[model samples]
Target: MSVLFDRIALIGIGLIGSSLAHDIRRLGLTKEIVVATRSADTLKRAEELGLGDRYTTSSAEAVKHADLIIVSVPVGASESVAKEIAGNLQPGAIVTDVGSTKASVIAQMQPHMPENVHFIPGHPLAGTEKSGPDAGFPGLFEGRWCIFTPVAETDETALKRLRGFWEALGSKVDEMDAEHHDKVLAIVSHLPHIIAYNIVGTADDLETVTESEVIKYSASGFRDFTRLAASDPTMWRDVCLHNRDAILEMLARFSEDLAYLQRAIRWGEGDKIFELFTRTRAIRRSIVQAGQDVDAPDFGRPHPLDKK
Candidate 1:
């Protein structure tokens, strides 16, 4: 694909930033990629990975001439990043972010953006339980949904350009308002991660369940939860803080449902258990049928089961 911009600045060289860099390089999405991070150590690691053409610890300096600037950091850092780079961003530059909490990021960043620049908040519903520059890999966004929660009165041309950019990286783009995006992601992404983290913590706290035994007995189900628990603590903490309301709402519902399930199990209500289990299994089947399971090993490939 042809390069979309002369220079693209990434203002956080962690998992998402480095993953964007990898895909940009792989797909030849930009003429120059400038990687920036708050930590000098991370910048150095990104340099070693050859994730970009230029590396810097200064966000302002990195965005100076860039036509596209992506702020790929924790939601809590959005304000600082916006303050640092607001003046340096090129006029008419399409600025976007890959922050998890949409409304909070927009709240933090929107005030600092100048009229000449486009500030669109985005969240890619894709990631692994990994962090840092080295954890990134190409094709991370391929077939993944990148949700752009554009504020009202957002520049349409700039939004279109950003859509093109993510498309070039093999992402399918969708748009929603910031609050709706937050609510939806709270149920789908945030709740699951919180549950995983809680479950792992619960297991760790059990006196009868030895740590060694937990480790030794972990099969596919427990192993998946472990992956979510292994996600970057700082990042997850920031997400929980920034998206507090939505997360709390989802958590409340989750607790209510869990209590019902627990009651059913304790009473040996086999029919209730069977009904809920069957419904949940049907949901998974629907996902498979819709081809929405990108994390599945057969993504973008024919499944042997399909042939059968």
Candidate 2:
């Protein structure tokens, strides 16, 4: 298939950025791939990985003449990237992002977009616990969800081109409003990761438990939580800070439910416990039934670490 883009510039070549680079190469979706990162060392590594046709630490230089520009930086750095590339973007170029948070990214990037360009904010609900260029792999977004929060007057042709880009990389695309996308992700992605980090931190703080003992017994159930806990600290920290309001709202609900469960346990109300557990189990079933592939742990095939 002919590529939809002549050049695709990827800023911040971490796991998500590098993964997109790999898929673009595999699918032949772009005539040339330009990689840019804040650090010169990371840019060198991306070049070493052969992930891009050209590499630079200057985002402005990288995006120049590129038909598609994807910013894969942390949500907090969105504005800086937007400012850096705003003047360099070619007319009619499609500017999108793979940030975890939507509303904030839109707010940051929209102001910097040129009138001739399309600034469509997007989020791909796919990533591994690992990060960095070395940790990325091809087909990471296969069967995954990529949500686009289009502006009220977004260009249809640009939106269609971006949709085709993601679809070619094996993602299922869906469109929603920025506020709605932020709210939905807060519950489904942000809160779960925060809860996992909290639980792991709590376990690590236990006075009676040795770190080695925690490691030894982690295989039972805690290991699953640890995977999310082990995610890139800088990335997750940015997410927590950027999506504060929605995350706190979801956290409040989570705490309320947790308190209810605790009350049931304390009062020996087995019926309440059973009902809540049953409901959650049914939710898992519904997810699987909706083609989530739950049999394969962590989204698709089980992580290699779990095989041992």
Which candidate's lDDT is highest? 2
Screening candidate 2 with a backbone cut-off below 3 angstroms (N, C-alpha, C), the clashing residue pairs are none
Name the runs in model 2 displaced over 4 angstroms. Answer: 296-308
RMSD of each: 3.6, 2.4
Please report, as a residue range, the 10-residue window in candidate 1 with the lowest summed lDDT.
294-303
lDDT of each: 0.90, 0.92
Over the full model, what C-alpha lDDT does candidate 2 score relative to the true structure?
Answer: 0.92
Q: What is the lDDT of residue 175 in candidate 1?
A: 92
Model 2, span 1-308: residue lDDT tens? 57889999999899999999999999999899999998989988899999999989999999999999999998999999999999999999999999888878888889989899998899999998999999889999999999999999899988998999899988999999988888999999999999999999999999999889999998778888999998999999999988889999999999999999999999999999999888898888888899875656545635778789
For residue 299, give model 2's deviation from the true position in Å: 8.7
| Colliding residue pairs in candidate 1 | none
TM-scores for all candidates: the values are: 0.94, 0.95
lDDT of 1: 0.90
